[model samples]
Target chain A: MIQLRNALDVFTLVMLIVTIVLLIYTMSVMLMQRGKGKTPTNPKVVTKVRCVQNDYSAERDFSKGDYVGLEIGKCPKCGDTLKVEAIYAVGGPKEKDQPL
Target chain B: MDAGSSSDTWYLILLLMFAISFILNFTDIPQRIQLWRFASYIRRRLIQMDEIESDVRRRLINYLGKLNINSPKDVVDNFMNNYFLIEPVDIEPIDIIKRLSHLINVRDTNVKTYAERYMPGIQKSERYNAIVALEIASAINLVNKVLKHYFKLGLKNNNWVLLMQLALEMPNIIRIVNSYSKALDAFFSGTPIGDGAGPLLVRYLVGNSEPKRIAEDTVYYETLINGRRVYAIKAEGPGANVGKPGEAVEKLVDMLGGNVSRIVTVDAALKLEIEDTGEVAEGVGAAIGDIGPEKIGIERAATKYGIPLDAVVIKMSLEEAINTMTKEVYDGVLKAFERVKNTINSVGEGGSIIVIGVGNTVGVL
Candidate 1:
């Protein structure tokens, strides 16, 4: 009877060890998955402005020191402030300081 | 049975239960994967067709709701852009009539029901006339849609009947010609006349009639207010006489002792659907026929002449300009000119400005 009782005690001890190990492994996995769900915060602030027409030429003959007015609009991509300037004519003279 | 043998039996039972549960869990994986793939395919196709269909539907509903009959031309123009992808094919008159009839029948049925609910007396009054006109417009739009559909199918099957049929329909043919001519006019005539600074001159050296050509050229030269030279060479004439503007520019440059530093070419640009009219966009492209050929020729000539090339493009829609040039459109053009002026300032060489108005100068001074 004592031998039989000792065998039962040994089996119970083995099952307890196995369950504890599994529980620890499951908890670790759940914690790792939870950590991955967080979104990274962005720090940069972006703004957009629409491009409007402005008369920069005093003589209106298209001389130097003239600038195109941009009515700034919000940038569709990255939500940054987009600045649009009218570039040179196609097949026309290139500006010394080209505003891209 | 011995104790050890009984313990071994219990262990085997536990292992069997685990195996059964594992097999059952894995059984659902293939079905889940299939369901996911099917859903993804449907989503992609829906997104692809949604934009085009929605645009078409919006225009159709708006026209139907208006019940106006001023001109079906605008409706056709909008329909071609929103629905038809490219040029219309040749189609038979009978087929076109049949298609139009089918569309009218459907619309009449729907409108009749709608009229009963909303304006029952409209069927007998002037309001009915407006409704009928709208129905006709819808029918015309539907016919265009059908033509587009069949053209695509015909291309795949190499069917000549479809092409010939499309060509036979007189009204459709007229619409196509009118649309092309209007587009050409808008492309050539950047800004509408009488709006800002009035209409500018578009000169063509060659065309269908010499008298017409002379009249056009004379009018262009006579209409100069500020004395800034603006002209365009069209492809409407024979090959020998087609490149007049280029030759004129060349002659002018040579007259100045060939010391030309840079060349500026100005023309009207077609606006995309998303682009607001008068929005200025710059990119390297052809110099004349399109961005490709024009760019190639300009680059080659500039290389030979050792001069720099720049271009200013004015944006407008052929359809919008044809229908009317509102104050807003005129303002847009003035704004574009200002932008052009700024662009020119940045170029230091003080090059000669060649404002080539691209389009048919019909009724334009």
Candidate 2:
């Protein structure tokens, strides 16, 4: 009976350690994720990008469709360089009710 | 090591397990909420199938009725309800439909069932709609089953790690759901998902009327750019579909006697968070999906021929890509069009260049 009790204590200690480690790992992950918006683990970010369009051009009123997003780059009509004139918080933070 | 301390350690173990369970279960609330949304959306679609009139329903009825599927909803519901048990639900159902249709059609070929059963002059569009109804039903079924699975798992809360992992992946899962929703919308509208972008750009660049049907569901036109010929290709648009642009590019390459110096492919790409919609990104290689074989074929052909391949991508949310072409995404079309031209321009006055506007050419003519 004494030996059995000792074995149980050892088992309980091992489980406690495992559980504590798992909890710490989980907490750290959650804290890390809190810093950045929940990006996918695979990320899928294109590092091979030769060119990126960062132009937050003025949010123009389109007669059709709600302004959900902006396609920045070369002007579709003309190949002239297109860039965002000002950031409008269109999609990123503060976009919930931010006016154009 | 004593019995008393062992009992205390057991208590500690129990407390830790309880804490871990609490956190894991708490973290899963967001995913459960998404599942609820998915459930409601799928329920709406299943209900809509009954009332929404005209040919799509009729086609579904006729197609399934012939299959002796008298109560289509029951089959769909059964499939939806029992979907979790359907080992390996990761494969997108719509992708299977095309292959399944081809296989089924081939198997039933000896009897000429399609021609014999349908009324005279039943348009291909009707048949396509029938297939779409089935695909949408399958997609809805998958989501329904998954939503239920998550609901049950949430209730159990036994597998905290599994639940947490799912919680992390919830965004992508929701992203796919949004895309499938758009595809469903496109099906009902009988218009392709933002098809006009690629083809319109192709047309603007080519600046020509005569579009040659070079491959199955693909079209190509040509224009002289700085004393060199540039071949523009896109799926035949203004129809309810994104044509096989990859195959079309291959066909164009072959038709040009394999002397094509450069190939530029343009398509819509899903944007990440903070990446504004309609953003154009220029890069290298193919930028289309759902046509894996075609992408491979093009890549293989390009490699064999030693032709440099460049890609111009119009970035938008998967929601935008699957849904009707929003003004923002459409705006990207012209930008992408311009980018395509620029891509061709940077390639230098080409001996012969192939510019493939790679996307579903659904609306913009």
Candidate 3:
């Protein structure tokens, strides 16, 4: 009877320890997430434009109304029509600054 | 231990376990504890969802505030709360595609009409963007409202199973809502999304050619590739809209008297978890993701004409599909462009071909 009691006590002690550990782990996770802040992320976007006459191309910060196939203005170097080629967001979900 | 002592120990252990279980069951302690845990978890997720919903609403209002409207908030609320589509009944399943098509068209027209009523004299592209922004907000609002409804219902009725299921599903729900929130920025800023891969490829093929409007919000350009006359079709863009490519293809086939030899489709496809994003893949059949009408129209038109249908797709995740176009997705678009051209050129016996770039052409011309 003493041996059986000892075994049961040991089992219960181990389970209690597991429950405590799990509680700590979950609470820590919640705390860490709270610390991270819930600010909505804004990804860095760029607009790529190429000269019509020459091969001169450049990428600038994305602006409203900039789209592929739209003529922006004359290229500084070539004096030709500069057309927007692409607009895309850079970086990934795991980047240090972008916590998406 | 002695035999009598061993037997007594076993009896005592069993009695203790039974007693504890009886207490737990009779008092509903275990279920209550489980319910509490699940409720706490779901509550946290509900808080996040609330944040996302409010954020989307703010962004929509900010975009609409710039327009010439009396009450931007009211317009957004109307779309968020009132706009909905009742899916066509499928019990009979006869003329279902046509019915669905009509319903979709009506819904789109209503949305556009609402936008026009509020923001009169705005450019069509801007109006389209406003409509898309409103849609994003509506989706987030719907998700938030549905989740809260279930959350409250479960709590009120003490439904532990319901709460547990909700807690389990909250992670994916939050992820989807966050993605929708991110997509708002893409639409408002006029940036192409991953779904725009198809239209971007079509834009590369149809450079400088005059595009004739073929279907509602859809256009086609007659361009020559390797001396083969190719009709490239895509949604008219720089605004968030997936134009009716199916109707366009059907009409174009009718106009040409079924002279189209091959129909090629390019679009973004959802990839497996193990697959790399922006992977260019080729397959057979029409690569369009419509409820029923658009895809059936393409299939029927191809079947009637006896044309070989080829599909080239850029693989991406659902989140990636809606969010702004990434560099990896753009590279995939370029790769798919090459693959599409190769498909067009592979025909030995030459005939006029229709290459349909099938996706939302937001921010792609």
Give the winner by DockQ. 3
Q: Kindly list the per-residue Cα lDDT of model 1 for residues B37-103, writing each as its tens digit.
A: 5434433433433433444445544543444433434533443323212222336544443354345
Candidate 3, B163-265: lDDT as tens digits: 9999999998898888888888888877899999989999989888999999999999998888788999999987888999999999999999998879999
Q: Residue B13 deviation, candidate 2, in Å?
A: 23
Per-model C-alpha lDDT, please?
Answer: 0.39, 0.57, 0.87
> Quality of candidate 3's docking, in CAPRI categories?
medium
Stretches of model 2 off by over 4 angstroms after superposition = A1-100, B1-130, B149-157, B163-179, B347-350
Separate DockQ for every predicted complex: 0.03, 0.04, 0.50
Candidate 1 has an lDDT of: 0.39
Indicate the worst ten consecutive residues by lDDT in candidate 3 chain B. B342-351
User: Who wins the TM-score comparison?
Assistant: 3
**What C-alpha RMSD separates each model from the true structure?**
18.7, 13.5, 4.0
How is the predicted docking of candidate 2 categorized under the CAPRI scheme? incorrect
* Top model number, lDDT: 3
Candidate 3 regions off by >4 Å? A1-42, A75-78, A95-100, B1-18, B24-27
Model 3 Cα displacement at A55 (Å)? 2.1
lDDT of 3 by residue, A25-58 (tens): 9999999989766664556888999997757999
